[model samples]
Target: MSSRRTLIRGGHVLTIDPSIPDLPVGDVLIEGNVIQAVGPNLQVADAEVVDAKGMVVCPGFVDTHRHTWQTQLRTVASDYTLSDYGLNIRLGYSSFYEPQDAFLGNYAGALEALNAGVTTIVDHCHILNSPEHADEALRGLREAGGRAVWCYGLFPNPKHHPFRFDDFDPSWRLDDARRIRKGALASDDGPVYMGLAPAEVEKPAFEAVAEEVRFGREIGAKVISCHVAMGGHSVHVRPSVTTNLGRALLLGPDILLVHGNSLSRHELGMVRDHGAAISATPEIEVQMGMGRPILGAALRAGAKIGLGVDIVSNIGGDMFHPMRSALVEERGADNDVLFKNDQIPRRLEFRCRDVLRVATMGGAEAIGLDSKIGSLTPGKKADVICVRRTSFNTMGAWDPEATLVHYATPNDVDSVWVDGRAIKRNGALLGVQQPSIVEQVWASRERLERQYREINIDQLRSTKGYQRENYGN
Candidate 1:
């Protein structure tokens, strides 16, 4: 028996492990923060019993591409194009945000994510205009009590913002990186892991940006994330620039490239050969009118491909829709086959469960956390979520994999455990008062909107290169 274990019995266990096929009726023993054992009819006297009867016990979902701050400003700039949104909403809204707004927005955002069955999120926060705001934003995320990489990013600019590799030496973004790095290592309570996100390739001093990437190693920044191939934004440089820098700086594992839509074959191969990762956000990409999916190539290139909901402001932020859309879009893109021919019968490309792998294991791999999380194996972190199959939509659903991809929503999630801690229990939040967060978020949004009305940001954007010339988008 495990020393301090919790045994979950009497249900189907889909560990989502490709190595060991699914378990129809099995028992799982979670010892401390690690999954100690898995088998049938496991007996334990002291461990609390979880009656997972008629439920699916799988790994918690990971959203590797989300703008946590923008979630507070949902549907604000929907009328604008990608470029228009960036110049108006992204840059415009960011400039107006004080530290308090960031703190409140991130706090609200993290709660929303946890409630939606996402155990981990790449909080791609690019609104950090100063050191104080960065710390405030990070504090809110850490207090929210979910696994997140507080991805550091620069504030957006309408015109081309050349990053001098030299000037980044002591800027707020780099300082935030240094401070978060120190805090993570020095914190006695626990680590609040932070990652670097220069927003886009064109935002920073390229050389300094490269220096920051190198500095990540020195400062223990485990991950470096960038908005790659997100073609819809007004300020979005050609996807080629993103892939080029990624090739230059993202040398190996732990480098996360978000929105790999325009990634070419050679670039995909480079990413694979370098052992990098690709984060595909189907919901936001499809919503923003980015061309058909590029995940297939990234997946085939042997790079670690993960799933994310992307910008919550543009679309609903639940991980469920992204997973659902991925399943449907991938099938539609390939016609259920990579290349259909008169001779070959749809060569069985990208299955439903395979996409689930991207959301779970692929995400972990992308962020370099696979050993601790991502799977329900012995000696791994007990980051688990149980989806009740008896829910109205999923009643009597026997196929566990199919049920998850098709019917399961965040509300149907029975429980969510992060590092053996039940932050979400019985379909409700345990530690935080979610209602208060919700109220505050709404208040903040209303306040921001009122403030937006005060600032003529649309008039401001008119000064920059807000042209209609699409970059082959």
Candidate 2:
């Protein structure tokens, strides 16, 4: 343990813990990696003091799912649909990434999260082209000094032309994943621990996916995440992903299903019943033609729901976008129903505080880290952020949660801490060589784009894009 103590003083605090009342002007006392006390007029000797006046101090944002390894390819798929992304980034650019490229992407991405007040993330890293790639990705997460669940992706990397089923091999990935579990990520007590992102339920046979889940449990994975029922032709298999999993007795509390846009009410109930969680990346889901977001539906079904950025390749790496999108989209959907019925709305069903909860507490719960890091409660890890409430966009806001949900941007993040260590202060990330990382990321992007440009678009489309018929359930 560490003996360092720091007191963040005089700020509007949103604990997000129902038992702990919100403090209009409060102090958070941190000793070592844990929050020791939280209340008004906290006084202690020899504790370093941080002035949080004019700030909204709260638990740091938790991103339930993000493809951190694609940081260098940010906005490359800005106008692309889900199919376009699958063909280009998933099957094309990912193949050209080297081990060093993975390191640069993950390191830069983790720092980007810290800079944006995201203290914890579920990094769904699927660019593991080689064992060296896995090592470098893990190294990047570790070196960034952030809290993350590095979910080892079990997706196959398309190396050969035609990208046939024959190229889909799981032996190498399984061995490497086990090696990572036994090696660097053996203990869940570390800042960065292990999770598993198995192959899409639609892509592989049910038995294969079940075995992967079994293996994940065997290795003591903290979370088992998978993309399910994304809609817009994303699911080619029949009977639904949740149905298959439920029948197989594979659904459990450890499961986190992303983008359940097309899931039925029964399916949502199944998820809730099994104690599984849902991560809604609303911005990307709507933009990529994955149908409307399932936030409202999941909420009604009483499923544990959280927000995610999904991929920076298409959207920003900030929690604000998803938070606002989930709220407004759900409200809009409800209003549309009222309008069609020729009735006036009584009130908004989803509120700002609700989405804020989804971004922090719900996210932590979704990823199985709530006990350690979600709310501003004593004995929990001191993962906190101070947002500038005095900024032009946020000034004069009556409700701090409303200001954050509607106005606060990543630029307004004034300070951030994870594990009681300040990773960002005074509106800048600490201990990061940002310029060097950016330069290296750009270099990697150039090489990747060059290789990507050399590939024949017609051949790629024929082989990887529209060749879904060849992949059977």
Q: Which candidate has the top score in TM-score? A: 2
Q: Against the true structure, what is each candidate's TM-score?
A: 0.88, 0.96
Query: Which 10 successive residues of model 1 have the least lDDT summed?
Result: 157-166
Q: Pick the candidate with the highest lDDT.
A: 2
lDDT of 1 by residue, 4-44 (tens): 77888876887777676668888888877778877788888
Question: For model 2, how does the per-residue alpha-carbon lDDT over 1-473 read when each residue is reduced to its tens digit?
Answer: 55999999999999999999999999999999999999998989989999999789999999988999999998799999877888888888998889998998999998888888999989998999899999999999989888999999988767735445355666898899999998999888968989999976677677888898888888888888888787856556677768888888888888889888899999999999998898899998999878899988888889998899998898889888889899999999999999999998898978999899999999998888889988999999999999997778888876899988999998999999999999999998887877888789889999999988887766767763237622452
Clashing pairs in 1: 82-232, 82-234, 83-233, 83-234, 163-204, 163-205, 164-205, 165-207, 165-208
lDDT of 1 at 399: 88
Residue 180 accuracy (lDDT) in model 1? 65
Superposed Cα RMSD, model 1: 4.3
Judged by lDDT against the true structure, how good is candidate 1?
0.72
State candidate 2's TM-score: 0.96
Error of 1 at 330 (Å): 1.1
RMSD of each: 4.3, 1.8
